[model samples]
Target: MSYEGSFRVWRGDDDAGGLVDYQVEVNDGEVVLDVIHRLQATQAPDLAVRWNCKAGKCGSCSAEVNGRPRLLCMTRMSTFSPDEVVTVTPLRTFPVLRDLVTDVSFNYEKAREIPAFEPPKGVAPGDYRMAQVDVGRSQEFRKCIECFLCQDVCHVIRDHEQNKPAFAGPRFFIRIAELDMHPLDTREGRAEAAQDEHGLGLCNITKCCTEVCPEGIKITDNGIIPMKERVVDRKYDPLVWLGSKIFRRQT
Candidate 1:
């Protein structure tokens, strides 16, 4: 049940670093985080990795496992063979602050860009009620733990560093979609802002963000595509165009 697992963990800070090989003890029914802790205890005492609530709910232990963004606590050691060298690396999309931890402040910056949910002026906190079906739509997106895996995996900002400024990435796309879908929300032109400002158009529906989500959120299918459809409906539909023009004249 116990074996020496070959691990190649990235070591160093923002200035410079490389993958340092380590032979760590692995046990049955253990996750990657366990192996990492064992490595810290035995071999690499100075290793830098961030983790909390090792139960996978805190979203604090995100890293690239064999080049895929995943929660270290959720990825089981059994997924890889004993002979296979497991490569743990910092998220390539963000600036590396240390070993497994990166500067995730970009996600916080993107979070700041999002406007909070705006309810109609007349509706009191307790007086408002929404249908079960309507509430279900936004509820799915609320499950996000702010892990930033979706943002890290998104190619718009991941592959192209320049796109970071314009693109809000999948996490915020779902947030915007949640607010836009809320029946009681008074916000207008959400779809327009999604397309024009947040760089929603950059997404090609590849669903990479959905794949890496530990919560199994249907980010692309449930959120992004619906918002894309809304954007098309608002922009290209003749009746909507006419209504917009008339509303412009009235204003």
Candidate 2:
């Protein structure tokens, strides 16, 4: 069975825009993206939306639904009643290019800031080995689909545009965290990078990023918090500092 659903889709470019309401037919087992597709086909022929692999893997359909960061393709229409008015808007953290499509180049800039993974010097590609426990930690973080939903919800950059210069947000924290935790990655100074350079201190553990993650990655608790603790331990704890100094002197 299908019914009419009202959608308040923000329509315009970076300069200005507002919610343009559209009444569309909702179908069984359809998602928010489906409603948007209907809108493109019927009411608003000029409506522009970016989506791929409508199965929710591509993370291209990132948007704010009812004021929450979500993947439009993953959000089931059945979650809302037939009469409930759904609101879909471009990610507020970034400039909108057109209707429902935001210029997410900020995330690309942040991605470039993260240093690439560095394997141990002696470990060639064929000889690389990792314990199951270490592999487990990095594996969890590698699941991120680059949705930027985490980046969009992070208040450090969300509310304060100035923070963009410093903050890489939760998504890249996952990237850094994975590299830092990887057994094969012998690179040092990631803890410092996460704290001093990437604005880890700006995160007050709101867990907003974790809540919106489609991958169910424990971004705040597992990645950000652990990285924060590691940073603090390396920076403030006398034992780790002394150990590092002793190791350096011996070498």
lDDT of each residue in 26-48, candidate 2, tens digit only? 99999999999999998899999
For all predicted structures, in order, the TM-scores are: 0.94, 0.95
Clashing pairs in 1: none
Stretches off by above 4 angstroms in model 1 are 243-251
At residue 14, candidate 2 shows an lDDT of 77
Question: Pairing residues by index, what is the TM-score of model 1?
Answer: 0.94
Off by over 4 Å in 2: 246-251
Local distance difference test scores for all models: 0.92, 0.90
1-251: candidate 1 lDDT, tens digit per residue: 99999999999999999999999999999999999999899988888899999998999999999999999999999999999999999999999998998999988898898888888898888988888887899999999998999999998889899999999999999999999998788888889999999999999999999999999999999999999988987876888678777776321
